[model samples]
Target: MQAFSEILDQWKTQQPEDNRDDYYKIFTAVKDFDKHIARRYDGLRNSWFLGTVTALLAEKIITTSDLEDFSEEAKSKIARALKFREQYEL
Candidate 1:
């Protein structure tokens, strides 16, 4: 699996100049994601990942058309993280 920074770097290269700020938002979110995961806060990690993805979709940082450009491995990680979060849910 690619590290978050590598994924971000790849993604940043593909984004248009006007949408670069959105990449920063994703960068911050990933940092938060790492922190949560490191602390064993499964729920927060999932929530942050989902929320960040949602916000990205809503804000058009990532669109259906461009989804393929994103890393599939990253998406898989998010999916696995969500499953882990569900296991710990009450």
Candidate 2:
């Protein structure tokens, strides 16, 4: 995780002209990391993995409703993903 943060910081410093897009790209990378780890630990069918991600997103939204600078379409995708997560007994 610290290594990922360092990479993110390096990318942001190198591309200072577009911080928002870079931040979103970092968020996606982190999310993909979570998904990869989850699959390694619990396989692809685990709802707990999705629930954990949904919970993280919800927590972030509580702190900052920016949704990682997501556009309306991306926000809709997040909404649907979270909705799918909510159906499980996490």
Candidate 3:
């Protein structure tokens, strides 16, 4: 939902009477958004889940509260991953 709003914000900037440069900016924004989606949604096998959720949290696309229902073991792992992100600025 947030990402859709982001896409809409990008879309709103390019008016009907906009110049070519403005359209190119919009194109770049959409391309960047696509990259974000692919990074988040691609290769979502169970093997890839921890890394994916860690990334989702790191990017603020999902919050820690969103993961509250998971098992404590999973929560521990995610906490460590979040720490690693903070340490390395990833």
* CA lDDT of every candidate: 0.61, 0.66, 0.81
Once model 3 is optimally superposed onto the true structure by TM-score, how far is the C-alpha of residue 83 displaced, in angstroms? 0.3
State how far residue 67 of model 1 sits from its true place (Å).
Answer: 36
> Stretches of candidate 1 above 4 Å error?
1-17, 41-90
lDDT of 2: 0.66
Better of 2 and 3 by lDDT: 3
After TM-score superposition, what is the CA distance of residue 86 in candidate 2 from its true location, in Å?
41
**How should the candidates be ordered by TM-score, best one leading?**
3, 2, 1
Off by over 4 Å in 3: 1-18
Best by TM-score: 3
Clashes of each: 0, 0, 0
Clashing pairs in 1: none
Q: What is the C-alpha lDDT profile of model 2 across 23-88, one tens digit per residue?
A: 777788899989877765675455454454456676453422646675676567667877676776
Residue 76 accuracy (lDDT) in model 3: 98
- TM-score versus the correct structure, for each prediction: 0.27, 0.35, 0.72
Model 3: how far residue 34 lies from native, Å: 0.7
Q: Per-residue lDDT for 34-62 in model 1, tens only?
A: 88556544455654765566445554567
lDDT of 1 at 79: 53
lDDT of 3 at 78: 91
- Give candidate 2's total backbone clashes: 0
